[model samples]
Target: NFATLPIVAIIGLTIATMGALTSLPMFWPLPTALLSASVAAGGLALINSIGQMAGFLSPYLVGWIKDQTGSTTLALYALAALTIVGSLVALRVSRSSAVKVAGPA
Candidate 1:
């Protein structure tokens, strides 16, 4: 239902914020990084909004695929394929070139 939207947003955004806070220290002097806190925050929000577009479009796309195929099987595979591809891409992320500003306790 439509109520799921806000709930997903709430959880997703909290996790995203935690991720940003945890990772910011690794961006010390990168060309795209080294940003002020506010600038980084605004950038994160912008990126999050763009990524959330999938939430709106993916369901509709899956439903249309279901109508065409007469089954949820293909739709489920499509979603699973996306997750797999994302995991593969994530595996390729290079180690951070910038050192952490805060050392572990």
Candidate 2:
């Protein structure tokens, strides 16, 4: 599961590097001064870490719910709905509200 982290980092870095180089402008401070290659690399690493943790935990949590419910199909469906709602909230709503919906962490 954790293996994906390295892969994501590699891929994200490669893409970001190519993008930066292609868009790189000849200037005193550089074109995209606000976002240097190092910062982009760090952001990619952060994303990879968070994604790996979520990927590892999501299935385990869903399986545990199924075991407790004694029905895998129902559990998956419930989880799907929850996932959709969660994604919507996470992407659009205030994080405070999302945390409230997510409950005490």
Candidate 3:
């Protein structure tokens, strides 16, 4: 599932450009796969909310980092680092069988 995140992040870093548009689609199935059909809607909603928040804040954060550092390198690195952290979290989630919800009734 999220096992692909680290690979995508590495690709993004190598490209040195934002790959959100392309990479986002790969993650769309995650919530559905992880949650029961009953709570899948909520899981999707939560993911959407987080995505929207990131979309709204990321530019500002990038700009701030650029202003402070006089370059976008640090910002990109920061994003990559965060991506790695997310990958680790995803790994943990994938290992937690107890978090998997029951199938549709």
Top-TM-score candidate index: 3
Per-residue lDDT over 1-105 for candidate 1, one digit per residue giving the tens place of the 0 to 100 score: 213588887887688578756754653333234344556677566656855987788999899998999877788688768856754543443243323346588
**Ten-residue region with minimum lDDT total, candidate 1:** 91-100
From the highest lDDT down, the ranking of the candidates is 3, 1, 2
Whole-model lDDT values for every prediction: 0.62, 0.57, 0.74
How many clashes show up in model 1?
A: 0
- For 3-61, candidate 3 gives per-residue lDDT tens digits of 35898867755565456456566567766777878888998999789879987988898
Pairs that collide, model 2? none
1 or 2: which has the higher lDDT? Answer: 1
Steric clashes per prediction: 0, 0, 0
- The alpha-carbon lDDT assigned to residue 54 of candidate 2 equals 74
Off by over 4 Å in 2: 1-38, 85-105
Candidate 1 regions exceeding 4 Å error are 1-39, 94-105
Query: In order, what is each prediction's RMSD in angstroms?
Result: 9.4, 16.0, 8.2
Runs off by more than 4 Å, candidate 3: 1-26, 98-105
Q: What is the TM-score of each candidate against the true structure?
A: 0.50, 0.39, 0.65
